[model samples]
Target: MESEQFRRSWPFTGVVLWMCLALPASAVAQDEGARLSALELLIRSPQLGGSDIPRDLPGPPGGVEVPLRADASTSSGAAMAGAQAVSATTLPDAPVRPSSGDASTPGLSEEMSPGGPEGSSALLSEAPRTGVSDGAPLTLLPESSPSRSFQVLPAVVAVVPGLLFHGLAPAIAGDGQTARRLFAMEGAGLGLIALGGVPIALTGASRRTIAPLYAVTLAGFSVFGISALANLYSVVSPTFDPGVPAATLPPLELEMGYQYVSDTSFDYDHFVSLGAVARLDSLKLEAVARLAPEDGNAQVRFGGAYRLLGAPEQRRGDTDGSSLDAELFGLYHRYPTEGFIVIGGDLGLRGRFAMSRVSPALAGSFAEASIGMSLQGYSYPGPVSDGNLHEQLLYSFGYGVWLGRGGPFKGEAMIFYDHRKDGFAGGLRTFGGGVVGNFGLRGRALLTETWGVAAEVAAGGALVGRLSLIYALGGES
Candidate 1:
């Protein structure tokens, strides 16, 4: 019984021994876990990964601390020492546990940490930072900036051509009637001109090309129309041609002449009479007062009519540009053609040069020079012989100027041609020119403009001349 009880107690004693030996392993295991936890904290913290920590490691097996870093290396000395220590233990044969120590002597770890090496490797495999933290791409704009007012390169395209039109319009208007019609035409055409500017202002377009085009078109349409109208109203009517003004009064001219073509081809015939032309038309009817010191000349013509544009219907856009004095006037001239009350059912080319110094400001009078052309057909020529004084050729062109410290009077110098053919009718050429310092005889003025009247005289071959009165009119401004 005693032996059996000792045997049973022996088993209990073995168990107790086993528990006692396991204490060291248990304590070491817990310490490792705590160490690993601290290592993980350091790894996760950005500050620890930078220059925050100091290196303080001891070599291998006998070392107290373990290396938690994934790339940690151990020394051979640490491994061998650990093996010898295990062999030296005189205890029963059992499995050896890991030292988990620094193992710097061997340059390796006793046991591999799960996922540690792989995780670190993956983190490094990622590409380095190329740009900002968010990591996105960049973009550039098409048009760099908003345009300035003068940056209209597109408008320039149309503007250039438009400018040309504006400058050349007056030179091409031909006559007063035509100029009036031009105003209407341009008013309509400008609608298109303005459109050219829109694209450049609102959309993508060449600043140099399209923008200029629009600008030029606007300039051309406006200036051309205005210049043509001005030229027209400055030449033929006795009343103020509300259309345009001579700015300053021109000089005065006076002359007369007579013609008779006893034959169509001979300068040898004997038929000559007196005639005069003191004004001409360019594009619209003009108002001019003139005097001819020749041909026993003296005449007066006035009406409430202001030199103005004909209604669209009256002018028929297709106006045969001709002088009022020489062209076959419209239905208005047919009631009994002649004088103020006589309806001159016909056409004739009347060219004249008249000027005066009745302008208050005459410094700008150099522009008073004028030239004109006309076409007229008469129903009857009572002065000659009623056989329908038909065919007419008329034109006037020249330079002139005027001056006045007093009133606004226009003075001018010009040459002209009048052609005609009928049964006893004749075609003659008149040469010579005369001057009249226009007196305040006709209703003419200019204010910011002024106006006045004057007479003219011309003598080419045949001593042809005229006697008449003329006037100028413009804005009170």
Candidate 2:
């Protein structure tokens, strides 16, 4: 009789246990739904005006819930009722997750920018909200975005339309300051060109004012070109850290080399070249000698330059590789085959300008210009009628970049133009007596504390190439 009663009670016990488990779950679902509905209604209230809040709020970890503050400005009856209903309950918090869409999409990035709804949602989801006055409105502080690592489109623009516009690259890179400066610089360059070029056109390039006007025009071109390059550099510099100028140079350096000269007018084709440089407090001394073995031709030059507005060459850390100096050089040449000797002295002012002053991207580069005159006289071995003195214009300009950022390797490379109608290279042989000067590329580097190499190639009426070994007395190791 006992076994029969126990069997009969088993089915009722199971049914009761099922009801006990199901009732709480059903009640919990209803309460969660009510909380979500209340929150959604509050978000859609007239004062809040946020109807896009998702209906299915994600559940919080550890079962903790967060409550949303209702706007204190709710005046309407429906809005007030919604606000009250939301304040009376709590909503479960959810871990914030980034959007599942492709991050590289342009539209998506724009929509997720700091001013967008997603940015606010991200902040709200990540930050715990508590201890806020109900009357105060929620205000989000702007979040700073990380700088771009590299940009290809802006770099391309920098080469194309940027060549003409000068600011397109930086503008595209979101560098408004750099863009504005470049635009201003471009405008100034155009203005200068107009200033000088218009006058020259009006005056037919008269000899009276041609020199000054020509200078102004060249200045304009320099400015315009520099600004254009700066635009490109600004967009591209994020890819790498820019190099800095060197602080010092070797105090004493000596060089010896072989030079090959190809000139139709001279019989000598091979020669030996030797040079020396000494740096002092504010004075620099230099000496050079060249000898032709086959024809007994010899040339020697000795000169010194004084720093007028810059740190000495030995210690140039004070400035950014920019300086102005006064130069004085004397030269002597003997030609056995040509039966002539030439003696001359050159006086000039040379200046270097750091490109970084124009734009931060142009660091480690500089532009140089020099102008002066040379007074020379030719002497013949035998009695010759012509004994008149000659005066030649001395001018040169070059664009140079510093080599090596650190360690023992240090030097500079330059592409340059020389205007003086002297030296082995001389001016270009033309129908008009070689008005254009020589163009060359030259570079020197110190491999160790006391050893280095220098190389040069120049072209004009003659093609000249030289490679030299350098020895230094003292410098940074």
Give the TM-scores of the predictions, in the order they appear: 0.21, 0.61
* Candidate 1 local distance difference test against the native: 0.30
Stretches off by above 4 angstroms in model 2 are 1-241, 381-387, 429-434
lDDT of 2 by residue, 285-385 (tens): 99999999999999999999999987887887746778899999999999988778899999989998877776665677777878877899889756555
Could you give me the TM-score of model 2 versus the true structure?
0.61
Report the error of model 1 at residue 36, Å. Answer: 70
What CA root-mean-square deviation does each model show from the true structure?
Answer: 38.4, 22.7
lDDT (0 to 1) per candidate:
0.30, 0.71
For candidate 1, write residues 134-192 as lDDT tens digits: 32211111122332122232223223443433222322322334334434445554765
Clashing pairs in 2: none
